[model samples]
Target: MGLLSQVLLLPFAPVRGSAWVIRQVMREAERIYYDPATIRAELASLEEQLESGEISEEEFDRREDELLERLEAAAGVQQGGGGFG
Candidate 1:
């Protein structure tokens, strides 16, 4: 952009910067959320909770299904098959 354009847009610089930061944070969050290792760790924790009687069998089954779906979605994304449809 020319100097005049930059000068005109300078007033919005803070807004632009804030938007960029938000995008970066969202990307990082998605990366962690879809990580296989993270998913596995969560699964282990869920199992522990069930074993300790912190959660009922029904609850465990529901949560396990959700985690399995996430794992499957992650795998699909890794294989370039796209995310949950």
Candidate 2:
């Protein structure tokens, strides 16, 4: 079973408001809150800006890597066991 499925099977796992419970459980996944769409858009804009000489290539690459790292960190935080709370 998947991790989520296993978690749901726990004896005290709340079911009635399970969505809220899960959201609360994952809330500290990260402080950065850019949605996937927004992140993609921002990355595209950064790329275009760099190509157009509006921003330095170094700046573009740095910010892009930082955003990607944030995304990875958030994913890790979410996948982590109920250890954040």
Indicate which candidate wins on TM-score: 1
In the range 1-85, model 1's lDDT, one tens digit per residue, is: 9999999999999999999999888888888998899999999999999999999999999999999998988998989965432
lDDT of 2 by residue, 1-85 (tens): 7999878787555664687777775764523353445567778898899989999978998999987876666567657733334
Q: Give each model's clash number.
A: 0, 0
| Clash list (residue pairs), candidate 2 | none
Error of 2 at 6 (Å): 42
Q: Can you tell me which runs of candidate 2 are displaced by over 4 Å? A: 1-32, 78-85
Q: lDDT of all predictions, in order shown?
A: 0.92, 0.70
**Which candidate number has the best lDDT?**
1
Please give the lDDT score at residue 1 for candidate 2. Answer: 77
Report the Cα lDDT for residue 14, model 2: 66
TM-score of 1: 0.93
lDDT value, residue 81 of candidate 1: 60
